[model samples]
Each structure stands twice: as C-alpha cells, then as structure tokens.
Target: MDDMSENAKSEQYQEKTGRESNPIGVAAVILLLCICFLIDARVGFGALIGAAAGFFAWSLLKDNGTRKEENADDRVAFLDTTVLQHNFPLPQNMPIPYAVLDIRGHILMYNEKFAKEFPNMELILPVVEQLKKAGIGKHAVVVVEEKHYDAMLNQCEVVEENGAVGNVLNMTLVDISKQYELEERLDRNETVIGMLFLDNYEDVMDSLAEDRQPLLSAIVDRKLTQFAADANGVMRKLQMDRYILLLSKGDLETLKEKKFDIMNTIREINVGEHIPVTMSMGVGIGGGSLEDAMQSAKAALDLALGRGGDQVLIKEGEKYLFYGAKAGEVGRNGRIRARVKADALWELMGASSSIMVMGHRNGDLDSLGSSMGICAIARAMGKKCRIVMNEVSTGIKCISEQMAQDEYYQTAFMKEKDALKEMDDKTLVIVVDTHRTSMVEGPSVLEAAKKIVVFDHHRKSAQDFIEQAVLLYHEPYASSTSELITEMIQHIGKRIKLRSIEADALLAGITVDTKNFAVKTGAITFESAGFLRRNGADSIRVRMLFQNDIDSYKAKATAVRDAELYLGSMALSVCPANRENSTLTAAQAADDLMNVTGVKASFVCCKVDDVVYVSARSFGDVNVQRIMEKLGGGGHFTVSGAQLKDCSAEEAKERVRSAIDEYLKEETT
Candidate 1:
C-alpha cells in the first residue's frame, strides 16, 4: 500500500507539472494499508486502497477549482453606495421635472421646478405608491383639459451603505407644460373652413310666389347666421344660396375629434316650412396664409356643388378629403362667357395660318362632334383646319361614316404621320372634349405642336391638359363637350350655315352623351338641341345612328343580366371578352337596368386585351362621379369612365364595390 501510494503521488505530480504533494488523508490511508500488508501476504491489497484514496483526493481538487470560478462575485461586493453617491447626484435646480427615490418605491427628494410647472399632483411618497399601483409609471398619462401628471421612477442603480447592498433610483421628470401648450394651440388653430351653397337657388326662388321667395331667402340667411355662430365663426351671405364662413382653426380639430359634427348640424337646420334641405360644402386648411386657404376652400366648395349637392369636400394641396356625399343632384347653372371668350380667341387664332382640331384616342361622340364644330369655325376664318383622331370606337362607327360623306370634314381625320408632314411652327392644335394628357389622341402631336388650345367640359382630373395649352376652357358643370362648343359657336362669326352633317354630328354627340337628353340635360341642353333641330339635325337620323348589330345587342343583354347592385343604389356589369364596343353597350344596358326595382346607380366594366374599362352612370339620384374619380377617372356629375391596367374584371368589380361602400359610409357616418 505504501508503494502504491508513493507511485500514484509521483504520477499525479508529473501530470500536474509537480505543483503539489498528495494530501495527508491519502498518505495516512496508504500507511494503514502498508501495516496491514506487512501482517499478511494478502496485504498486497494495500496498493489498491492507496490508489482509490489518491483518486478521491484528485476529484476533490477538481470540484474546489470549479466552485471558485462559479462563486467569484462573492469575493467582490458589487453594491458600492459611497461610489454612487459621489458619481451620481440629483440636480440641484433642473428646469425639467426630476425626482430621486430609494429602493422600495420610497420618494427621497423631488425638484420644486417640477412641482411649480405641473402642480396638479403633490409629489410625495404616497403619490409614488399610488402611481406604482396604477401601473402607468412609464406611460405619458395626463388629463387633457384638467391638470394631472404621471411620474416614472424606473431608473435603478446599485448602492451600498457600510457594506450593506441597496438600490437607488434616479429619475428625471418633465413638466410637459410647453408640450401641452403647443398641442393646445395646434388644436385651437386647426380650422376647417368650408362654404355651403344652395343647389339651383334661382330656380327654387323663381318657383315660389314672389312674396314667399324673399321669405325663403331671409330664412336661409338667418339659419346660416345662427349656424355660423354656433361654430364660433363669421358667416357671409355672398349670394342667395351661397354662404362663406371664417372658422376658428382650433374648432376644426375639435370638430374632427367629434368626428365632424357639421354634417349633423346641417341636418338639424330648420327651414321655415317643411322642406328637405341639403348643402354642398368645401373645406380647406393648412395653407401658409389665410387668404390662400380660403381660396382653396372656395374651390373645393365649387367642386362639391358642381359634382351635385349634399356633400363635404376638403381640399389639402392637390388631393381631396371627401365626406357626406349621399345626396340627390339638383340642376346646375353656369356661365358661358368663358366658352364665348375661347371661341372669340379662335378668330384671333389667325395669328397662325392653320389650325388642327383633335380629340382623345378612341374618339367618342362628344369628342368627335365638338372637334367637327371647331373645325368648321377654323375653316370659316379662312385658315386650313384638320381633325386629328387615331381611332374611332365601334359605338361611333356610324357617326364616322357620316363625317366621311362630307368632303370638307373628310380631309379632317389626318393621321399623326400625315399631320406631322403638314406640321410647322405656324400651326395651332385645338384639343377638344378630353383634357387628361394620358387620354389625348396622340402625345407626340402635343409634344410637336408648340402652340396648343384645349376645350373640355369634364371635371378636373390629376392629368390636366390645360397647363400645356395656350388657351383652356374647362366647365365641369356643363352637360357635354358638344353643349360647351355650341355655346362657343354663338360667339364665332354669324353662326355659319350649320351644315346638315355638322348639325347631325353635333346632335349625335348630344344624344349619345345625354342618352337623348335623359341625363344631365339642363336649360342650355334643351336650348342647344332646339338650335340643332333648326339646323337640319333630323331626330330620325340621330336614332338610326345608335342602332347596333344583333350580336352587340345580345352582348348588352348579357351584361344587363350579370349586373350586380351596390350601396342599394349602384349596379356593376362586367364583360371579360367581346370584340365590339362592350363598355359603351354595357353602360347603356346599365342605364336601362336602373329602371328595374331598386337600382339608383350603375357601373359597367369590360376587358379588352389586358386593359379593363369602367363606365359609371347615375339616375340623378346618386353622384357616381366622385366614386369614379377616386379610381383615376373623371366625367360629368352623372357619367364618368376609368381604365385599369393589369386587373381582371372581377378585381375591378371588387375595387368599385369597395369604393361604393367607402363612399356610402362617408355620407352616412
């Protein structure tokens, strides 16, 4: 046993680089085993016992090394309060709110500046406990109009007193007075200035007895005056039905916070006798100057009324925020002086030796008819005039046939290549009907022509051609481009013998666009139709122009059968494939479907190749123009169109449905 112990110790010393000797316990065991071995030959077991004792000693050394590594922190006390007190001291007088607390959520000290600034709550230990219990210690909790404060004491640091460990919390409190003040000022200054106008005010007044009419005027004025007072704003009765308001900017935020209660306020206006009342409001704000803001506000109001009444439109920069759009349309009255002025300028167009009248791609009746009228005027001025159109849709194929019968107009449909051949610096291109740059017949023609003129009646859209043209006449409230051009003809030299073909073309445009004077027909619409009748535009020929092939009629019927209604007022018809003019045919069929049971508005969609086209219609009971405009399209109050790229018929239908739902929700809630 003694020999075995000695050998084991020697090996252990070698493996450990001779660092230490074997333990005394293993040596004593080895000595006892050696005595036992000396007594008996079987005592050779002493070597085994000594080896086992040596192994146990080695295991104890390994465990001791591991324990030292794991419990190293016990040797160096981490909590040192004296070092912290000297390094981190609470500020004596900090502007921002600040606090100091000891561990256990006890407030040790607080800056008076915090209390002076936010005196809502007395900062004490009790308050700290209350705040901790509330579980909003780290949140920005404040009573808006009332005074309140939330203190967060989350700052934690280790501290030691006489070698005893503890924690000290140092936190900074913010008065937040200036922040609340600025927010209050911002809220107070956020004004939503809007203008309200009575629809067809003159017509309504004229319909009343002379004595009662003045009473209605006074009644409207007094109600508006009271309403403005309620909003803490100044009201101006600019016209019989038009009222201008100067509202408080702060009230605007409050109104928005109340979810825009102006809608409900309008519904509550009591007209003298029992009468249904509705108004179109335009709102604008956030302009650097008040005057510019008011101008924007007025423009928005005009658009709202122009689109039909009983709606609120808020204009911000170039985009619009629309609301409360569910209202029936009343008749629109607009001035034609602008169109007259545009036509008078045409005579002065003699500055250029020649003129070209162009329409948008796939020229419709209104575009073609309006361009023909302008062409006649240019020729009368002794300047060579040409009509530039790339394609005529199948719906207007008959009208194109009639235009070809006239030699004067036959030379008008000049292709882009042919038109470029005749193009020069002295040429003026007159764009008719459509105003969007994307919808123009040929963008290259516009780029080539330095001098341009535009005449359109569709509502303004994102891409307007007005800025590019030398002269622009855009009347959104007008019935059609033909109607606008007819008014312009009155100013041009003695209304020239309206050629039978020219008259028919103009009448066809009015018929196709107005659905034979059924939609959006106003006093001027009737007046223009009467003049065309005198100029040899036979109604029989106009009706014949609308007749379509049997297959097209069948397609129209199919679209009608597939029509889907939305908002209890709109219908959608989708045609995925058709070689004919499916969009136009579907639009007509949708209009016819409106007479069925409960439909008030209609939309038709058709897909050609990869592009999808949508046509919107209203029975004067709803305004589909705003809905279509949201989908990147524009037209009159009752009719509009849009094109969607890379979309299936079903996807387009779903989008239109979402728009309808959003629009109705805006009007109702």
Candidate 2:
C-alpha cells in the first residue's frame, strides 16, 4: 500500500515535468512492478510501483537533478506571471474582462473572465486590431453579444531573461450597457419642435372657390395630423397659415433620412386651386427650454422664407441645414412685404445721422447698380452717403467707365478703408445684392455700423449670414436686387426721379441678372423693367454694358470651345487664367454652354493666383444653386458660382462633377 502511494506520487511528478523515460528505464519499471504485485498480490500496488520506477529512471538519465530543476523553474515562471499581472492598474482577477497580447496581436495570456465575457474571438480580434492602430492607452466602445463594453488598452515592453525584448499590450473591458441604455432613452425622449408655414397660402385660398376652402383646409389638417401621429408627436395650428409641431429627436432623424417627404406630399395638394399647396417647415432640437426651441424654429422659418419658402431648414446657431426643393417664382408674399420693408428703410435712413451703402466683393452690375440706387435714395433724402467701391470688375467695367466720364461720380465712390474710417454707430450701412459679411465690399464697414439694412434678391448664403439687421428686404423672387430697388424708388418717399444714366445702370443690373429677361422673369420682373424704361433707361446703352471686349470675347470662346459633356447633360470647361475679366469670361462661357443641343447645365472654371473660380449655369432642369451650395457658394437656381482656394482647374472640375453626381444620386434615391 505504501509502495502504491509512492508510485502514484512519482507518476504525477513525471506528468507535470513532461519527460520521456529511456527503454531500459521502462523495462526496469515493468520488472519492479511485477515483483511488487506478486509479493503483495495486489494489482493496484503493482501498477503504482511501475510508475514510480519509471519516474526515478527518467529523472536520473534524462535530466540530472531533473525533479528539483523542473519544479523550481515552474515555480519561478508562475511567480513572475503573477507579479506582472499584479503590477497592472487593473487586476486580472478582478470582476472584469482582461487580456494580454504581444504587439503582433498574438494572445499571450487572458483571464478566465475574459474568455467567459467575450466568448466570440471573431468580435474581439477585429476591434483589437483597430484599437492597436489607434495607438496605446486608447479607449473604445464595442459590443459583444449585444452588450456594450468600454474597452481600454495599454502597452509596455516585456524583456525576457534571455535579453530578448518584445512589445506587449494590455486590454481591459468594463460593461457599459446600462449607461448606453440610459443615454439612448434620454435621446429618444428629447423634444424636437417644428414650425410650418403654408407657402402661397393666400394665393391658394384666394384662388379656391369659396365652397372648396373648407375642404382644402380639412385635407391640409388631416395630412399634418397624420404626419404628427406617425412620428408619435403633437400638432397644433397656430394660425390659418402657420402651425407648430412636436416630435422626438429619434423620429426627426428618420424624417431627415427620408428627406422630409411631407413637403412633397403637401405640394401634391390640388383642390380647385391653380397653384399647388406647399409647406415650408423649420425644425429645432437640443434647445434646453421649450421657448428657446420655439425661437430656434422661428429663426429657421425665416431662413426657409428667405431661401424661397418651399424647403425645410434646421437652425444650428450660426449655421443651418436645408432640405426639400426650391419653389418656383411665385411671388406669394411680395407686394405687402416689400412695402413694409421700404417704409422701415425710409424710417431707418431718416433716423441715422449718416449712411453708407456697399455691394458684394467684385461687385457685379446687380450689386453695384443696386448700391448706386440706394445711394440715389440717400442723396434725394439729403443724407450723407457714399458708395463703397473696392475695384472695377469686368461685369461693372462699362458702367464704371460711363460713370467716370461724369464729374459727379468722381467723388461719389470711396475706398473700403476710407468708408470704414467715416463709418459710425448711427451710420446706416445698406448692403445690396448679397447679405453675407464675407462677400461684402468691406466686412469691417458692415461690422462697425450700428444700423444695417440688407437688400438682396439672391438666396441667403448659409455661411457668414449678416445678423442684427435693423431693416432687411430680401426677395428671392425678384429677378435682381436692381428690380427690388427700382420698385421701391417708385413709391417709397417723395417723387424722387432718377437720372437717365442712373436708370441705365439699374436697368443694366436687371438685364444682366435676368439674362436679357430670358430666365427667372416673373410678371413683377417685367413691371420693374417697364418702370425702369419709363424712367429713361436706354436699352441701347444698357446692352453696351454687356458687350465683351475683344480679348474677353476670345477667352470666352476658347472656354466654350473646350467644353466637355459630363453625365451626358452637364457641360464643363476650363478657361485659362485671364487677369482681366476672368470672372466675366467664365460666366459668359457658362451661359454660352447652355445653348448646347442636350446640355441641361454648364460649369466653367478659371484659375487665377491661388483661387479657382467656378461659374455655374443651368436651365431649370437641374438645381445648380444646390450644387453650388455644396461647394460653399450660393446663388439663383439658374445661375451660381463658387471659388476653390489653392485648387487646380482639374480639381475644381472634379469637385463640380462630384457635386453633380451626388445631387443626381440623391434625387434618384
């Protein structure tokens, strides 16, 4: 029995050491086991005896002092591993998932908790590799079996006793599923407020037969209510033409992904009315209070209206994101708004001690002509005013030359710096054609003036939108800012008649912006033009302002000659850098490409210095305004341009193509 116990112990030691015995050692062990079994007459005792003999033989021949050496080495290794794990900030034995890996992502050791917590190696390996690339001491959130974990990684160098060094990474994971659940719940419950305005509400109501008004109202109500119910929200009618709605942020996200089909759905409403009903909605979220959110929605609604009132806008403090298509030139809320703005502008001019008017950078005819019209208004009022003219662009070169021939214009224009010096808090700054401070002839002048007035016909740019306007008259429906100014001059103050030359400038502004009244012209556009003509605007003189010089005409022709059709519909070309009239050349080239057999849109790029200027033109078949907006520019749907800094002509062409492709993809989807 004692020998049997010894044999069992020896067999266990041999298994732990993992050594093979020699052939003689095996034979001796068998003989010894047989003798022991015969003497004891016990089979169990004999088996133990053989195993013990084999272990003794293996220890003596295979490794001298093999039992103590192997056991000592194992103890040292075990102690070292335990000490290494203990030195970590997070203990491996803690109630957490822990793993150690070499820099090559080879698993060195892992706790039982890690294997149990992350049973799927498929999920861990990929995340670990990403985290490794993210560098050491990085934290990332990953999911395993639908449970979220906040994983942390650390690295160190491990030097073995043989003087070999290797990089080691330590990964620790903590369960964050509960925290994520709470966050998701909060996010799903956040409030989203939307303000809806019925675009062309009066036009629709007035056009409908008296008996159909009630039916139309009911249909609109049903559609809005259904939309609210689908989103698990509340809808309330604020006025006959305005509404407010409440929804959760999560639901708003879904609507954004779908591009707010409700706008299109509303546009489909036709109940005996010539004009289809359309809704302009503004959404606000993440505002701390209901009133704040409502305010944001109101601001967004203003942006939607300013951008032509057929889209949805989400106000983000200084920036905004828009969705839905632009409305046609309906002029739904035109006469009344224009009259009110004119009255307010007259009041502001009357109150201010001095006034200064300016146009956009490199002022085109619409910009410069509108500024001159405002200057005329100020001059008639006998208020001190000057037009800020930085440089003579090709679009306004003819008008400038005409004005230079007259002595009254010699002191009429001032440099931006001189204008800034004379500006004051009470100086009313009137900005025409463009509302962006960055696009203005002088941003400092706009920023310094206390009372600012904006008169623009272009869509409000999303970047650098001028704020704190004492009086603003923005009409996207107008063909040009010149059109708006011309209409205001007729009824605003006293009977202040404009000179024929000044009328020529204003008419030329409208002529260029409307492309000789060939695009974006409305009933009101013609009325404004007729008013300009009656005021002595010479058509022969205005046409001369658009005639390109010989070199400019040649450059434009070269651009048109090199036109390449993109996507079978868009014509793209590059005009070589011409220091003189580059913008004019690019624009004329884009306009000429519109004459192509199947072209729907055209883009012309001209690189000058470090800036690549792109002029875009479309034929209402494509929304070139939106495409230009993607490239950080904004304009009318049929005409727009963008500038790319430090970009090659080829790069600008690629960007325009990409923008067009993306727009087409979105429309198709």
Candidate 3:
C-alpha cells in the first residue's frame, strides 16, 4: 500500500475498532480511498482526504519511528558512558581500580575489577583536589582535573556518534597513606630542631637611641629573615620582637655550620648611634621531639644570655658548643634605677638583724662604693652592718682609709675563721657587684649568713649563687654597682649622710665603668652621675682617685705604645710586667688606646702571678664576650675578661692571636 492507502487503512482500523469491525473492513476503506484518488483528477481532492485518512490510520508507524529514535539516543548514551568506563582497555572481566563517581563525589558505579582491587574501600571519589583541601594532599599519587578527561582517563579512544562530543573520565585511586605514615615516623626518628624567641628585642634595640631603633631593627630582621630563607624554613615575627621558625632536621646542620657568621652578622648591625646590635643564640638539635628541642633551645638561650649576649651556644646531650665572640667585650650600662625593688625584698631583708656586705675579689670603686652606700642605709635602719674584704688592692686605699677613720663604717678583714664565729641565723649577707659564688672575696661569708641578698650589675653566669641568695638585684644592662646603690640611697632619703669621699668613690666607679662616658652610658647613667655631683662628688676629687702612682702611669703609657692593631679595628696589648694589678692597668691602657684614629676594639693581656689575664673592650662593633667565653669565661659585649690558668704569658698571647685571626676571617666574608 502507498502513503494514501496506508493512512486510509490506519483510519479505517481506528473507526472499525470503535465500531467492533475486523481487518477486512479496514482493508476495504483503504481500498476505497486509493481507488478514488487513482480514478479521476477531480477525485484527487478525495485522494487528499484519503491521504489524511491514511495518515491517521498509520499513526502507529509514527509511534514506532519515535520509539526507534528514543532507543538510538539511549544506545548512544550507553556507548559514551561505556567508553569512559572502559578507558583503560583492560580485559572485560578485569577488576576496575577506582570507583566511578558523580560530580558530587558520591559513588555511582563500581566495576567488579574495582571491587576486587579495593574490596574494603569506601565509594568516595578520592580526587586530588578533595585530598588537598583536606590537608592530606601529600598522599596523592596523581592529580586529575575534570576538564582533562582525555589525559586523565589514559587517552582512551574517542567514539563519535550522531553529532555530540563526549569525554571519558577514568580515574585511578592509589592508597599511599601507609607510605606517608612511614615517612612521618622516619622524620620523628631523625634529629629535631627548635628555636628561641629571644626576649627583650625592644630592650636591645632601645639600647640604641630613639631615632636609631628602627634602623637597627630592620638590620636585625633582615639578617634573620635571610638566615631562615637559607635554611629552607619559614620564620615569622610572632610578636613585636619575637619570632617563630619551623625548620627541618636537615637544615639544622646549616645553623651549626653558620654559627660563627650568625654572631658576626648580628654584631655588624649598627644603629647610627649606639653600639651595634647583637644576639645570644641558643640552638637545640637532636632532641627526642620538637617540644624537647624547644625546651633545649630555651635552656641554651638562657646559657648564652647568662654568659652574656653576642655568641652562639648549642646544647646537645649535655654537651655544649660555643662559637664567635672573639672581641671579649661585655656590654656596659651607665643607667641607674632606684633600689626600691618589689616590697617583697624589704620584707625579706627586714626579717633579719645583723647584715654583712661584700664584693668580688680585689673590690673596685663601684663594689666598695655600693657596699658603703648599703651600709649607710643599714645604719639608718638601726642594724649592725659590717663590710667584708679579703684583701685591699691599694687601688681603693684612700676611700677605705677614710671610711675606716669614721668608726661607724667598720671593716671585717679578719680571717674566715674569725668572721664565721660572728655569723648567726639573724645575719643577712649582701653580695654586691658579683654573682658567681666562687668569685666572692670570702666564700665562707656567704656560706655562714643565714639569709643572702645579692646585688650585681654584671651578666649572669652558670655558677651563679642563686639558691644561696634570698633576693637578687642583677641587671646586666646597668652601668655600675655604685649607680644602683646610689639609686637605693635616694629612695631611702637624702639625709643618709653620704660623705664626700663616698661620693667621690661612687663617681670614680661610674667614670671607670663608662670609660669616661665614651660608650654604654645611657640617660640613666648621666642622671646618676648628676645625682652624685649634687651630693658633693667633686670632679677633681674623683679624678684624683683614678690617678695612679707615677710608675703605674708610666707602665700604662708603655702598654698602649706597644699595642698591636688587628683587623683595622681591634688593638691587642700584651703586658708581661709583674705589676700586682697589671690586668686592670692594661685594661685601662686599652681603653685609652681606643681613642687612636682607627681603633674599634681593644684587648689587653697581662700576667698576674701564675695566671694570664685578658681584658677586652669594644666600640660595639665586636663581640668580646664570645672570645672570653671560649676560654671558659663570660661577660657583656662591650667589656669582658678571662683568666688563662697554668699557661705562660706567651702561650696566652698565641691563643689571643689565634682568636683574633679567626674573628677576622669571619668578618671578611
């Protein structure tokens, strides 16, 4: 049947089904329409009607065609999806290695192959981006983007059907969590490193003038930043002057290697005003964990500071490593603050009756002056105070003689046997200008006193007598012990009757410590000096106290003339004289020699009896404390000293030379 015949037949079938007729009736209607259109031209109109009737009769054919098209679309979709699923071209029965998931990461399908490979695996998509966002990206073996399906899906063949473009997305899942865990375990087993925040950064920077603080801070920050960068670690300023660094085990060795440069680097930063800024770095390596490393670093840092700043000290397994600090200068502070410590100190001291005041061996002006000042206060409190001395060096003879002339300021030069007899539970011992228990003039005095109070301006030491002292007033930044004592007297009252000789002694101490106001004299230093001046400390009288005997003056002049220059900055003077206090004389000569055209630092080595003593001074461009520390001594950056026992003066001089050479080598690069 043709088109008109087919439609008429479909129409006929519909009408016949409604009227309860069979296929014979439908065929008759189809024949009638076909005959009408074929017989006459006018009957073509009837053929049109017949065609419409045939169209209606054949509606099932149209439905069948629609169904065919729908089936084709479904087949095409299935083929596209299959291509993606089977992108790897593995055997038909091979298990897929990854779960098929939708865009939302939910699993849509899992092949038998995938099930076999990851039987217990969750159906999560386990994509790279998802892992990275969750901070577990380190375990990812491969990263695939949705757009790079052709590459990520193993470059499976493309199938073109109809006019649609489709992509294959085959993802492989690799479980490397075990590997990551193993690496983490290994890292834990390796050496761990930690850092110190280096407290009082502002205090260090403020040691420079107000206008110069920023410059110094920038210099310091830049060097530290660069060092952190070199270590392949991240360093951040946690606070104003505090920093936190995360370093790997491998990078810690670099820190140890560059230890010398670190000291040199810090000491090189200038503020355009005061001394150069330096740091005391403590490194802890090979700890059980990062926390232990941090604890060790803290301990090492305290050691450095206690020894005095401007050196690198490392603590590992109870062993210590010290580096840099060839200049041997302990920092000086002329500033003085009132001795009115926390109320707790007064209460602690008030609990005692008889008090003893003492100082380091061969007490200097500052030590004696501070003790005298304390004695006056003790007298005001109606307490019996005795100044203890091992032996007078004659350097402080005039002041000591005058104080002795006044019966109230009594001296206890009796042997230790006698001093111990007088000591009792009510005795309060005040140690001035020294912290080390071994350095005190009379160790028994400290051992005998029931309660000990320590006031010192020097840097701390490992041998500090902390447990013996109930109260400690140690300020490494202060200028002199005399200045601190002077401040305490002011708080007690001006009516404490400070004698002219006492005032002179205090001023001389300040002058000697500050090197005639050349370095380390802060605002508080001059203020203290001014206070002493007002209390009748005549400049001429103070100057008279510093004037040595004629022979001693000549020795000082000769020592300066024989000084040798090192690194265009440091001057070294070796004194072989048997002068009883040649160490002090040589140090004074070095200080005087610093005024020479290009001298930046001065070191004086002198032999006293069997011990070779070295005294160092600096313009803040060098770290002398580190040098002294290497010889088992410690002090501040601007002034430091060390004693070389059982070594000849020549051997000591050679050691000094070697230290200077090493220091110069570090600075050059």
Best by lDDT: 2
Sort the candidates on lDDT, descending order: 2, 1, 3
lDDT of 3 by residue, 1-669 (tens): 599999898788665444344699668767876777689867967666767787667766666676677668845664544654544243435433544433333443556656765465542344434543443213334433321111122212344444434433344555445665677667644554445444346556666777777777777788888877887877777566566566766676666666647656666666665555566667776666778877887777766665545566677767777665444324434223344552334566567767778888767887888887777677666676677886776568767676677666555344455667788888788888888887788897787777888887776664444566777677666777787777666666655777777778788888878778776666777887998899889998777777777777788888888888876777888764788567668878878877898887788878877888788877767767656656766566778788888988778777877776776665553
lDDT (10s digit) by residue, model 1, range 1-669: 999999998887655443456599758867777777788857658666757787778767876775565445422433233355454566767876776666566555556775665465543545566556655336544442344454565756554443434455655544566677788787576665677777656656555677677776776677777767877888887776777887877765454555545555555544344344567778788677777788889878866754555667778778777666554455455545655665556655778867878888778888888887887677677767788876778867887887788788676687877788888897888888887787888778888898888877776653354566777776665677888887777656474667887888888888888887877677888888888888788999988988878887888888888887665657788753665877677677767777778887788888887878888887656667777876877776577778888999899899888888876765565
lDDT of 2 by residue, 424-525 (tens): 678888999998877888888887888889999887776678887878888888999999998888768554678777899899889989888998788878
Candidate 1 local lDDT, residue 112: 77
Comparison by TM-score, 1 against 3, better one: 1
Question: Could you tell me which 10 consecutive residues in candidate 3 have the lowest summed lDDT?
Answer: 146-155
Cα-lDDT of candidate 1? 0.71
- For TM-score, the strongest prediction is 2
RMSD to the native, candidate 1?
8.6
**Which runs in model 2 stand beyond 4 Å of their true positions?**
1-93, 101-106, 133-138, 154-170, 316-320
Q: How accurate is candidate 3 locally (lDDT)?
A: 0.67
Per-residue lDDT, model 3, residue 244, is: 59
Go through the candidates in order and give each one's C-alpha lDDT. 0.71, 0.83, 0.67
